[model samples]
Target: MTIAHILHRVADYDAWRKVYDSVGDMQKDGGVTQESVHRMVDDPDNLLVIHHFDTMESARAFFGRSDLRDAMERGGVQGEPRVELFE
Candidate 1:
């Protein structure tokens, strides 16, 4: 099993969430099997997204996609996202 861990700050959680929810197909196409979202207690705008994949290669490929960047930008992401893969 592999997990793509994405951490980023968004300008507005509610607005970002709308865009995030709209990208369901992107996530499905990326080979994501499951997902979980978390928000920092002290900073509501800070978000952590965990996407479970069947393999590390899939996780890595998904994390490196330009479309993902575009999606994040469209979602009101405030800065560069921090991404990691765990297997």
Candidate 2:
């Protein structure tokens, strides 16, 4: 299994969350098996998302999707998200 740790900031957490919640099918379609969401204590807009996938290839493919980028932009993601992978 592979785990992806993604950290990014949003212009508004509430607004971004509404968009995030609307993309529930994206995760499943990307082969994500598990997920978790967290917010920074010092900066509420800073968010962390952990996603588990069956393989690194699947995770990488998901991360590289243009639709995901568009969704993030539409969701009010402030800047590029930092992503790390774990096995």
Candidate 3:
């Protein structure tokens, strides 16, 4: 399995959560097997996101999608997210 670890700040956590919840089908189709969301202890708007994928390629493809970018914008993501991968 491949795991994607992501960190980013959002303008509003509630807005980001709404967008996150709305992308269930998209995530599944993009080969995401599972995901988790968390907020930073010191900064409420900061997010710690983890996604499990079948392969590293799938994770890369998913993150490269324009729809994902659009969703991030809609979710009020403030700046570029930091993404790392592991197996």
Candidate 4:
């Protein structure tokens, strides 16, 4: 089944842009296929990241790794990201 991963952050556009740019190469190398990425117009600070994989297991395997977590932290992520998985 296909899975969906959602992320919500409370940082400004510049901050989020910096983090997104920093992770560009890593995300490509990590096997995450970006489906779509968008920011709410009403709330510029809110962002939604959507990615898809062959299975939930594959998604978890990639997301559960330490390198991604480290990259996120180093990218100045202030709070815990809300993650949701769905078919």
Query: Which candidate leads the pack in TM-score?
Result: 3
lDDT by candidate, in order shown: 0.90, 0.92, 0.95, 0.70
As for candidate 4, its clashing pairs are none
lDDT per residue, candidate 1, 1-32, as tens digits? Answer: 99778899999999999988998899999989
* Model 4 Cα shift for residue 57 (angstroms): 0.9
Give the 10-residue window scoring lowest on summed lDDT in candidate 1.
78-87
| Candidate 1 lDDT (Cα, 0 to 1) | 0.90
Each model's backbone clash number: 0, 0, 0, 0
Candidate 2 residue pairs in clash (backbone atoms < 3 Å): none
Q: List candidate 2 segments past 4 Å from native.
A: none
TM-scores, one per candidate: 0.94, 0.96, 0.97, 0.74
Q: What local lDDT score does residue 29 receive in model 3, on the 0 to 100 scale?
A: 94
Please write out the lDDT profile of model 3 over residues 1-87, one tens digit for every residue: 999999999999998999999999999999999999999999999999999999999999999999999999999999899999999
Report how far off residue 50 is in candidate 3 (Å).
0.3
True-structure lDDT of candidate 2: 0.92
What global local distance difference test value does model 4 have?
A: 0.70
- Candidate 1 versus the native: TM-score? 0.94
Candidate rank order under TM-score: 3, 2, 1, 4
How many Å off is the CA of 12 in candidate 2? Answer: 0.2
